[model samples]
Target chain A: MSALGSIVPLAFGALRRNRMRSSLTSLGVIIGVGALIVTVSSGEGSKAVLQAQLATLGTNLLIILPGSSTSGGARGGPGSGKPLTHADLLDLVAGVSAARYSAPVDRTTTQVVIDNQNWLTTVYGSTPEFFAIRDWTLARGRFFTSGEADSGAKVCLLGQTVATQLFGNGDPLGQVVRVKIMPCEVVGVLGGKGQSSQGQDQDDLVVMPWVTFKSRMMSQDRVHVGSILISALSPDEVSHAQSQAMGVLRQAHRLSDKELDDFTVRNLADLAATQEQAADTQTGMLRNVAAVSLLVGGIGIMNIMLVSVTERTREIGIRLAIGASENRVLLQFLVEAIVLSAAGGLVGIALGLGGSLALSAINHWPFIVSPGWVLMAFGLSMGIGVVFGFYPARKAARMNPIDALRFE
Target chain B: MSGEPLIDLKAVTRTYLTGAATVHALINVTLTIAPGELVAIMGPSGSGKSTLLNVLGCLDQPTSGSYRFEGREVATLTRAERAALRLSAFGFVFQGFQLIARTDALDNVELPLVYADVPGPERRTRAMDALARVGLVGREHHTPAQLSGGQQQRVAIARALVNRPRLILADEPTGALDTRTSIEVLGLLQSLNHGGITVVVVTHEPDIALYASRRLVVRDGRVISDDRQRAHDAAADLQALPQKAA
Candidate 1:
């Protein structure tokens, strides 16, 4: 170990004497490692942002839509049955063991008009429990009470985008907006949620009480629900919630064990997981690209080291003649290569992390610092140093000292 | 003054095969070098003076022959063992001075000890002592390029002496210097020999051969003449020359 330790300074001195050449030789490794770090950080950031948006939808949340119907061998897909009734929503809320918050939903696209300006937007109808299930918070006023919902009051909540479009700088609270010829008072404005994972604006819908929607806006008055939003008490209870909800729905539709139910329950967790898997594939592809770049960088190091060995033949000869062993000569050149690449690796990491932080700040994504990735990249760079430095080092070690001494 | 032989060679021959032609660089020749002798081997270019120096320095092995240092045969040692022997027992100098460029003289002198795994403090002390012995007391920090030709040669001699080896092999030590610098370098070597280290120098210059106590002339792979003489005093010669401004 002491013998190996002594070669370090000699190696560093040799490299330090050729500063520009050493740095240029390491440039390929720098860019390779830097690109690797950026790819990993950005990939991690994107995943974090996706998970956060999923959190807003509430962990283990589920949505139920009316199931398909088969009429004379013509089978329609889901959302084709008789629209779900208010009684079904109430039964599911009361019967499902793991279900925490359940609310009936109804929605339509219509023009929301203020005094002179009008905009086409989605309007939704649900009980107050919809806010709890969807984890939505109000920005200005309160959500309508249960009494207001049961009495079919004309009060409505304005999403941030709709409020901004209709009221602009004016206070949207207590202002009546016309929706399909009916004037509804805006009781509150929803908080901004930015964009969804699909890049759609989340704050673009207006919401009203279910009873008001059934009585005035909906074309049919059979107390039918377009869909139902439900969330489990906890993430672990999602599967249990799904099975219980399915049983209650099947029984309510008067279906036997062999008969298909008239409702479909979709687990949002599974959807999020599938999207995460897709992101993982993308991350894997980026990593492969990084590995290829590292390989190219390693080749660059090998090429330069070979040239250096050729250039320093006389030096090698001198050291050998002065009692340096074959291994000592090998270690000197190998360590020089390692120091070059390690310096490049560290500089690349610093630059990559800074670039990642700036990007996250500009794009409003979460900044993730993964020490494990940094270590792996550094280890890989060192490994490249060893692997690439070996052939040239061996060539120098194998040289005959007498011939090397005589080399011009 | 002769004691037990420090180096013994028996019919050592070195042959080189290049493109199906065998060049006999050295023929079978027996020689013994005793301790405390400054010997010069003189031959023209391609007359194999270098080949003889390399064999003596353990930098090359004779194609066929027996070489013994003290009493141990050299042909039986492994490459690593031979290297270790060279590290601990032999020091070498070359026509080029062979000091690593861009490295300070102190570090250049410390090279052998570094390979020998000597501790840093002791290595530094011994290297400094060796530099002082070569009359380069305050030039430890000077690189080869920063030093004059004679100074650079002194640094190389310091590196050779830093290990305190039994033998020093120098091939054309004064080849790159002018007459004055060459005398200065030869004076340093003479001083080292007076201190009881065995010094073997290979050169073609009769001026350098005159400084040694013994000379072996090589021609056509054969030692044609061996003569002993009273060694010239290089220091007295340096003193006789006119002094330059310091």
Candidate 2:
């Protein structure tokens, strides 16, 4: 009686007549749509998980790496370039508007020995403020104080992994481990930090007062330390703080106007943003490719429907002679095509959702599915049926009744 | 005999091209049939009998000539308009019985009304009545495959009558049936003609043609003779005349 009701029976009849062919056609759309769904969902999920990890590093932190005359080399330039000095740090603390907290760290890779056991680890020479800058915490005792650091106290804190390795479930507190010639007492144990995506152990390190490590242990006048971790008040002030810190350091270094800046900046927030953009681009690209398969599936339906038209030529003529209008005849075949594609789309959506959901467990990652993709796949299939099915439908509708009656 | 001609054709010509060759299926044909007339169009193979039925039933457009159906000139009718004419003014009983396969008798009969946008209840009621009139009320749910050839033809006839068309066009309606079943179908068609419905049957068999009161003999594409004969039980008596005469 209505358009919806009329098409239902017609579509149903078509599907009933060709069960296996219809299922096969739908399988094509299912695989294409499912692949795109899994790709975009997993991509988005990975991006979210990665960003959450980056957030734990503190969005406010800015990194400053150690190098001599511009990022070219660690080799000293001109008159033997000095390591990041306290004068440069103190000037920035006094002059910069956005430096809420900053620390100049002295870092190296060295082996610490206890009896016959020796652990190769990254050693940090830092003030107490370094913990606050990197958003780290102590698992056991206390960090070295500012006074202790300034006074060059020969005490150190073992990272969780190093302590566990050397202490063997026994207390590392009040115990002493050898670092080069000096034996440093373990005053604290830092919390466990697991491996990064790059597979490096975060807890395989030790921290000491900057003064004790810099002057007494290494004894070299020039420092080739690693990164100086700084934290700004807010993420909005990071760019400003960075520039102000850079300007203060450049004036302190007295570089020529033609010289390009030496150090590399690793802003976790910016890194997260760039990765998000790349994921979005990849999602779009994958979705487009998936849509092409939907298009191909539609074309397949048209091709099959065209064959069906020839096979059913006499049937169409019978309908026409029995008083079916051209529009009615067209609608019959069109309904058949649409029913096929829509069925395919529905099956594909289920398969895709199941795949992604199951993949979340199999791969141990988050899975996400968007409703928009499902709707799009369905609409695309229907559109393909209508657009591609028009020609054959027209041919069927225009068949001569006399010739059709005689068709064998 | 008393009423106006329900169909009038003036020099209708229908042509079709097969690759490079042209087929003059029907040419220079003028014919007229009034209400309540029982007419038979008799012609051999390749004589354009089916083509003539297509034109007469408004299922085709003549390449040249005028055709009036129920007082309307249908020479240039659009496909939709011809479909409407088929729905409202003419019903067809095809040679193959042409019942939609896998569909029940009632569904087959109700199909044309579906396109006419007839409401479901009224269509069902009228289709049932038509099937009952053709002695197929018990077989309304039977598909063509499940029914005998005679029963299938009766369902097709019921489908033809469901629209209450002014003209009933039977194109070899009994070709697929036995001699006994053909008589039963021809008897029903004659009864419908007796009820003031215009009936036209196209048959090459003289025995079949003898059942109709009026006959048009076709030679080539043109009508060679139009004559009236007394009603007869031609299928029973025709054994004396040789099948070649038919």
Interface RMSD per candidate: 1.0, 1.4
lDDT of 1 at A149: 90
Model 2 interface Cα RMSD in Å: 1.4
Q: Write the per-residue lDDT of candidate 2 for residues A1-408, one digit (tens) a residue.
A: 364566568778867888888787667667776776777777767776666566656558777664445346566642244456667677777767787887778778888889888888888888888888876788998888899988988899998899988888989998899976679999999887666545677788888888888876677543444456678879898888888878877776685778755554456667777867877888788878887887787778778888888888788888888888877888888888777777777777778788888877786677766788667766876777788777877778778876776688
List of chain B TM-scores, one per candidate? 0.97, 0.92
- Alpha carbon lDDT of each predicted model: 0.88, 0.80
Worst 10 residues of 2 chain B by lDDT: B237-246
The sequence of per-residue lDDT tens digits that candidate 2 reaches over residues B29-80 is 9998888889999999889887898889887789999998877899898878
* TM-scores of all predicted structures: 0.93, 0.89
The candidate 1 chain B region of ten consecutive residues with least summed lDDT is B75-84
The alpha-carbon lDDT assigned to residue A387 of candidate 2 equals 83
